[model samples]
Target: MAEQINLDKDDLITFFIHHLDKVYSAKSHLLKRLPEILYQVHFSDLEEAIFETIKVVELQRKRMAAIYELMGALKNEGSISGLTGLIDDSFEEIKTHQDNPELRDMSILFYMTNIEATEIASFQVLQLLAVKIRKERIKELIKENYNEAKADKALMLLITTKYLSTV
Candidate 1:
């Protein structure tokens, strides 16, 4: 059996900060991994799309960092184990499809979509927490982050659909 922990408002804020740190770490990891994934991609259009998204992701990471600074949270000690596992699984999937260009590209799009969905969900929670704690700036930042992630997910879905139809 697992132990259950209770959290008050302050503790919840701390937890939110910790989760934000995890998101920052995950984004950092993705930034490093995207180039390698891009190298594996053969389609020029898909590659360009991914490159543009990476720029957006970089900006989002900076925004998250700014929010962390606003919250007086400097350290990122917690790990988002689910994201770590998902990244590992995506790499494995990519490796398995290396010989198939279309499949590899599709896999990368799927992986990115999954990541965007996770970030959207996380930002939703963070937004609610910010509202609860009356952190207006944090709330606004989170809302902006959520919107960006949602747009990214939609873009990925559009690409996946168009690409698959052509193939």
Candidate 2:
């Protein structure tokens, strides 16, 4: 049987709050940037997938907001470092492949999946932290986002193979 972790609940809560702010901040930024990212792709399937991703992000933001309401924690007050670089790299990828539409579309898929993969790891951490801190409701909310991130990653993988065959 697995032993229960002996940790300072206060420290774990603080740690959870810090990352919660980071991910929520990142999701807010990426939420604004997603439409632009979606505009970069030309394929119907990829565009559809991106539209679904935007919907998932919107839901994720609301989920995090609910958690914040529960904790009485305010959102990040300043420019916080999180997933900005990954989003920027998505634009850069689009720009670099301008001469080739297929490559541009493919690169967008690659970078977006990269961002979602990072988010998956982040959400897993948030979930684990919630468990450690004994917040079952928050853990459940984060799990929805975590599972969506994983599903998006798998969908992106499927789109990659489809895009490649068409290329």
lDDT of 1: 0.82
Per-residue C-alpha lDDT of model 1 across residues 1-167, encoded as one tens digit per residue: 99996658898888888888777787777777788887678777678778987898898888888898888878574564766557667777777888899889888888888988998998899899898878999899889889999998898898888888887
Candidate 1: residue pairs that collide: none
Q: lDDT of model 1 at residue 125? A: 92
Backbone clashes in model 2, listed as residue pairs: none
Residues 1-167, candidate 2, lDDT per residue (tens digit)? 99997879998888888888878878777877778757667788899998998899999989999998998888773363447666776777678998887888888888888988999999999999999888999999999999999999999999999888876
Worst 10 residues of 2 by lDDT: 77-86
Off by over 4 Å in 1: 1-7
Question: What's the TM-score of each model vs. the native?
Answer: 0.89, 0.91
What lDDT is reached at residue 3 by model 1? 96
What C-alpha lDDT values do all the predictions have?
0.82, 0.85
148 Cα displacement, candidate 2 (Å): 0.4
